[model samples]
Target: MDLHMNGGIGEASYASNSGLQRMGIMKTKGVIEQAVSDLCRNNVNFPKTLVMADLGCSSGPNTLLVGSMVINAVTNTSLEMGLKSPEVQINLNDLPTNDFNTIFIALQELQGNTTNGKMRDVHHQPSCYFTELDEVNKGNIYLSSTSPESVSRAYLEQFQKDFLGFLRCRSEELMAGGRMVLTLAGRTTDDPRVEESNRLWGPFALALQDMVFEGLVEEEKFDSFNLPQFTPSPTEIMNLVKMEGSFTIDHLEIFDVNWEAWKIMKNDNDASKMKEADDGVGHGVAKAIRAGIESLVANHFGEAILDDVFMRYGKCITDKRSNKENQSLVSITVSLTRKCDI
Candidate 1:
């Protein structure tokens, strides 16, 4: 039940339906800028060639957005310091099923003679999760408030191993004093079962329950499926970094984003009109979730019900919004530097 984005530019493809994720990335641009600036300013032994990597970089417009920003930051900082911008080696890594070709095409379109002789060298690494875990939990529902202790323990153990492996690998690649900025969906509370951590999936599970009631999907299947995702709290992340002892956290910030923040509409002054627009915020969020997890769902529950399942999921989101429920997603961005003496 490995999860990957729906590829290419189709309706459900990550390319067409990742505005929420893009917004999250854009919100962390300040942190990324600060990290790059600090890396350049504090590391006097900085090499003439810079290497940067974007982990879990899915394809689409947002795919190359960060790289472009890094380049701009380096170039501007160099000018401010009366030095030349270093040659940048940018690496984009994601699951093998990701659309690297689409990303490469987008990169070509975006990087046409704009590197300013900085020697922009781009590389792509097709990989899955940094570490392996049990497949049963891959696409299943996450632990909720009522979940037993054993379930929570299993999930936490898996995350610990995966995250530690991830840090170890990056520690080997990054030079001493090199910086990395990472952004991911995260929970603000240490408790994994909090509403902020599982709200989106709670409604999604209800939708599947409805399907089970209607005999559209098997009850056993619905009960057994779980999402392979985990949203760590800032404390959890800090603990992992301390345990790994290879990277030091420079800055860690959490952001709260409304589910409706990604809506794109031309009628800025027409709230009523925008509410009735075809691509409402609720539907957009549902589409983004579907794009990320539909393949896994299809694999387990059969592809025939994907359309119905996501359609109901969208309605659930809309209903929640109408009821004035809190539908915010939490994001965590952390800046880290390799330990000089590690």
Candidate 2:
């Protein structure tokens, strides 16, 4: 696993919560609430029934924030159905190398926040379990990774196979009538730039190129660089789930999130430090956005014209902030659900 990815667990939390909020995902939290309410209504009389799971749960505000929403959804639905609340098993998952410490800290904060219905008893804690995919059992909620963009064609095929395996494994754990909600960065499958499109990455690549031109990063290392896999497309995801023949799809909607705030922050941080006077390496804010959006320049464009390239892509993504052009962002989220077969 790459450090960029391992470190991205936290970054994913930050970006998801921030980008979603900026992009209006908070508005769709109601969908989960409504779905849970409906699910409970159909199965209320079953006392042993397990309800939901938040898979790929990161340890951060999103973990708690989204978990609270799920709990409230179940609580309200349980009330309407005249049944006891179903146990919500939130699984905070990551590679074995993820910083458990941060996740632990976030979990601790969720310990006694009873207002959201997570802490049911003063003595017993919420039914929160931590598991890697390898150890996951049937009945856990499946949340997908938000960070990492996929590479070119060959990698995408292999990536799909692995993701299918993961989905199949987790689908086996869900109880019948149970619902699993997963979020992924979504783009149209037929887009020619499918290989290069990563909502979280458009900017990072630009910044790296800036550093390379400035002699900060070695040139050879750039060749070996590859982005992580994003959720390919809604069609592709649907096909994968259908192929499983275990879990049935419930809902799938795409939300375009505004990532301008995060983009601004990253640019600000880089610009402040990258000035020639400082010992720190900072690529100018404008240049970073350019590198992220347009890594592959067209023919006949030389490195000498980098500034113009930066400005062009920068304008496409930026919104006016403080009468300056530093803030720029683009992101989208796809929400999907799979029901467990009894």
Candidate 3:
């Protein structure tokens, strides 16, 4: 997979602008904690040495946060059972392009720091689509109303081919009784091309279009590029899991949170601070997006135009927001247990 988040600890890096993703982690923390707690409590084959893996754990504090939470859950479960805490191991996997230096530093700093509920066990850090729905993505990126039927079918076909591979690979890696808590951007409707189901790809598309108009980006290159991604509906996920036949779903839930809901969830109720943040909401949104996809965009379009592109993207966000249009981020979270070998 040519997939990797923007690296580094700088402002535009994924590490700095990952608050939205961190919010996802926070939103699902309770469910994740409960899943781990159940595994420790109910699994008769629970090992004294525990191994936890966070797949696609891109750089930033959030990676550590996930590790810490899982470790804490295991420790808490053992304590409740009046048993000694298990030897915990963490395996963080990301593309080699991710910023491992940040995680390494965080791990070093977290040693013997049990007060914060972060991971204290230092395990080795390992390094680890959008397709051409572009015409419809004209409004912003992602499938839009005008997307043709053929294009949509192409997307589904590609997802089927790729996701099945993903499932089969993970199935082989996980031990029997291993649990995976997956949270991804998903659509509630089967027809993601509908305007209502578009994820937050708006401003970026506008920026690229503007650049293309100004002769800044080659039309040929832009047209050829596709983000290899698909937002599977709940039914689609169930079918895929059943088709793969390696995991059984223990729980599933769909969540739709307003774009600004995560900010409020921080409980930073200070009006002045919120207003200050609101003032730069455009810039903030742009930076957050740039952090996640700049690498992909840069890879396709080159890095020269990124600053100008995202600057325009920020303005696009402000303009869109001004129209009183709002969008919610929909997440499909599932808890899966690795099925035993027959």
Candidate 4:
């Protein structure tokens, strides 16, 4: 199935609710700047034409966040170096279901603006899976501590297959010395039992599980769903690159932050904060999470149950995190330089 974030600028749309994503993009600016600087000074001449791509560029206000940052990086670096800015070709891509229109419309106003010349032209595309689960794993939307060992193994196998294919394609697309940077939510270690990945997906899984119990969503419908997310450790990626032999790791870093820290209400001391905000953490998270997965959930279970489903979901989030102040969200960033075609 083609899965995408809910589109448009409405309250429930990703454009309005993607603050978490914007935060991540903010964190990556330094790394992106460094990459741009390296690309400029390390070369004999600042390459006249530069190619950039955002592989999973989801639509919204933040859709071009990374691309714009890169453009700025190049422009700043060129000015600092007393060199001319290169003509930049940016390729923004996502699933076919993604709302590309949102991005195109935003770029319309900035197309001929005073930033370094930026172009949009993409010439290619690429494409993965998990199936079958034991009775114990039924109705669970993602890997959990209770998930059978085979469940994790299946996910690992699939991710390995998919990621290796990703390396192969990119190796071919990039020049021998060209650079690529990847930042994703992944585990600190190879263990599937790791709590961080579980915490990240926990709320959504819980929301859907409760729906199954309340008969809002059929048990079979819930059972058949699994997010094909495998949180690979840095070592796992390093090993994959070594096996693929197309890229050498230039940089690898891990960052940890409180999960959805932005939405956490400020005060439990007064006891009025949550009440005044009408449960800010829960209500805010429901909107944010729903913005991301509304299309998927509605595609699977029709759109009519949305309001009731989110009401319960908000309560679930409040119940779990009302007291717990911190939940870990791990992000791994890796930089690689293409070395071979395959």
Best candidate per TM-score, number? 1
Q: After superposition, how far is residue 126 of candidate 4 from its true place, in Å?
A: 7.4
Please provide, for model 1 over 154-198, each residue's C-alpha lDDT reduced to its tens digit, 9 standing for 90 to 100. Answer: 778889888999999999999888898888789988889887788
Worst 10 residues of 4 by lDDT: 266-275
Mark the regions of model 1 whose C-alpha exceeds 4 Å error after superposition: 112-119, 130-140, 264-276, 323-325
Predicted candidate 3 versus true structure: per-residue lDDT over 211-285, tens digit per residue: 899999887766655566678898889999999999999999988655553232222222223323553566777
Model 2 alpha-carbon drift over 4 Å, by segment: 3-25, 47-51, 111-151, 192-200, 261-342
Ranking by TM-score: 1, 4, 3, 2
Give the per-residue Cα lDDT of candidate 3 at 159: 78
How does residue 134 of candidate 2 score in lDDT? 27
What TM-score quantifies how close candidate 4 is to the native fold?
Answer: 0.87
After TM-score superposition, what is the CA distance of residue 229 in candidate 1 from its true location, in Å? 0.6
**lDDT of all predictions, in order shown?**
0.78, 0.46, 0.71, 0.72
Q: Which residue pairs come into collision in candidate 4?
A: none
List model 4 lDDT by residue over 1-342, tens digit each: 647888877778877766566656666668888877887888875699899888987777566667677888888988998988888888877777777777778775344433754565643242312244454466467887777788788888878888998898888888877889998878876687666677646666788788778877888887777775778899899999999999988888888744454442211212123223444567777787788877777777788878877877777777777557445567788888887455
**Model 2 RMSD to the real structure?**
11.5
Q: Cα RMSD (Å) per model?
A: 3.6, 11.5, 3.6, 4.8
